[model samples]
Target: MTAAILLQLVLNGLAMGIIYSLPALGISLIWNASGLFNFAQGDLLTLGGYVMLSLFGKAGLPYIPSFIMTVAVMGIIGYALSQAYFYPMLEHRVNPQIILIGTVAFSVFIRNLVLVIWGTTPQTYKNPFGSSVLQIGELYLMPHVIWIVAIVAVLLITLQYFLRGTMVGTAMRAVAQRPTASYLMGIRNDRMIALTFMLSTAIAAVSGVLISPIIPLTPSMGGIIAVKAMAAVLIGGLGSFSGALLGGVAVGIAETLFAAFVSSTYRDIFIFGVLVLFLLFRPGGIFRASVSEKV
Candidate 1:
């Protein structure tokens, strides 16, 4: 590829990667803490996007406040879902495999619920950034793309700090590593698990808000994006934060380059095929070693 074309591709990749990474982070956090793969995560993202779209796009609320409201409301929904459904199941000592099925059912239920409530029609939200594009040298970018990158960076940094630098962060890490040990050490395991769900949902909601302006609002959007996020998490190494970020960027670049050079329709197929290869040969992911213990 030419230099200009390469630069543009990398930029496109980074923008898409940022969007993809947000949900991956959520998945990693939940998996690490609870040992449950939440299939409903993507639907949660869709719910967040539609909630914001409805409040701001349909209700004519101001952007800044509406955005805050959307995040807060989605966060609560995430926490509530965990508390109402996931946590009770865990407490009752239900089978992990069955919980996985429940999550899948939950995802389907949420998507169909959206369809029934909003009808089959797709909805569009007005972009707060408008149709502005930025140019640097031979590279061109959209204002929303810039927002996506910046927001992703901020969220990643914040999560890193939260996991590494704070008391709650330390407790969370301890719980992830050894829940029973953490409980014996006076860390509330149940609370930590709940917090994990809330945080995961919050991150998903943020991703939805950031990308909604660009992609439009639709019920089915989350499923595909969720798959991409899952690929990112698995490729990066399950339960590894840095791995998720790196994996997301890698997948984004791969997708963009493939679409630019190869066929866009085959991009996902090619990317997922590579993922299968990785699973077969390096299942522990790029950034982590295979471990017998949880996470």
Candidate 2:
């Protein structure tokens, strides 16, 4: 294969991997905070995209404003879901496995609900970027892809700071680690939970809005992403943020390169095959979690 072809595939993979990383990171964050896996994150991403569709596509709002509104709106939805459903279950001491199942059910519910509202037709919106391409030497890159990389990079850096440096972030971590003690210290654990959900959903919104321009929006589109994100989280090492990101990029690149150099027909099979291999040998993933988990 030519070096140019290889470079192109890798760059494309990087863009797609960044998309997967958003949800994977969110999964890791929510898992750490609640010890409950949220299988509905992909649907949340779908909702975010649809919300952006309303604000930007139908209403003709500017991209920046639409994005901000989508994030705010989805953040509210996440907080509400936590306050109404997740927190209630926690208060009643619901089984963690049951809560996880609930997320899967919720995932299905969101897709159906979206169908009820948006119908069966796939949708697309005019991107303000307008099919622009950036050229550097012999390489050509899509503007949207570049935007994805830059935006996700900034988001990752900001998130690293938020979780490590900010008081709210610290309190949330404390609550996750020791809820009773944090309560004694006057940290409102409920608020922390709500905040975690808000952040996670907002991240989903970011992915949704970013991805909507690149792909047609379909009710079940999130299902494809949901599976990919789950795979990434498992392959990355559960509860490890960096691992989630790394795993996502790794999977994206592998999928793309395999499709390009090998065969496109069995690309997904190759992906799952890689997943099985990882499970067999490196279940903890490349950046192993401090606490390893078995597949």
Off by over 4 Å in 1: 289-295
* TM-score of decoy 2: 0.95
lDDT of 1 by residue, 1-295 (tens): 5798798888888888877888888998998888888888888888888888888888999988888898889888877888888888887989888999999998999899888877667788778877777888887778888778876787778888999999999999898888889999999887788889999998888888888766777888889989999999889998888888888889999999999888999999987998899898898899873545542
Whole-model lDDT, model 1:
0.86
Question: Number of clashing pairs, model 1?
Answer: 0
Give a tens-digit lDDT track for model 2, residues 61-127. Answer: 9989988999999999999999989998987888888888999999999999999998879999997
**TM-score per candidate:** 0.95, 0.95
lDDT to native, each model: 0.86, 0.88
Task: Look at candidate 1 and tell me the lDDT of residue 193.
Answer: 86
Best by lDDT: 2
Model 1: ten consecutive residues of lowest lDDT: 286-295
What's the lDDT for residue 19 in model 1?
79
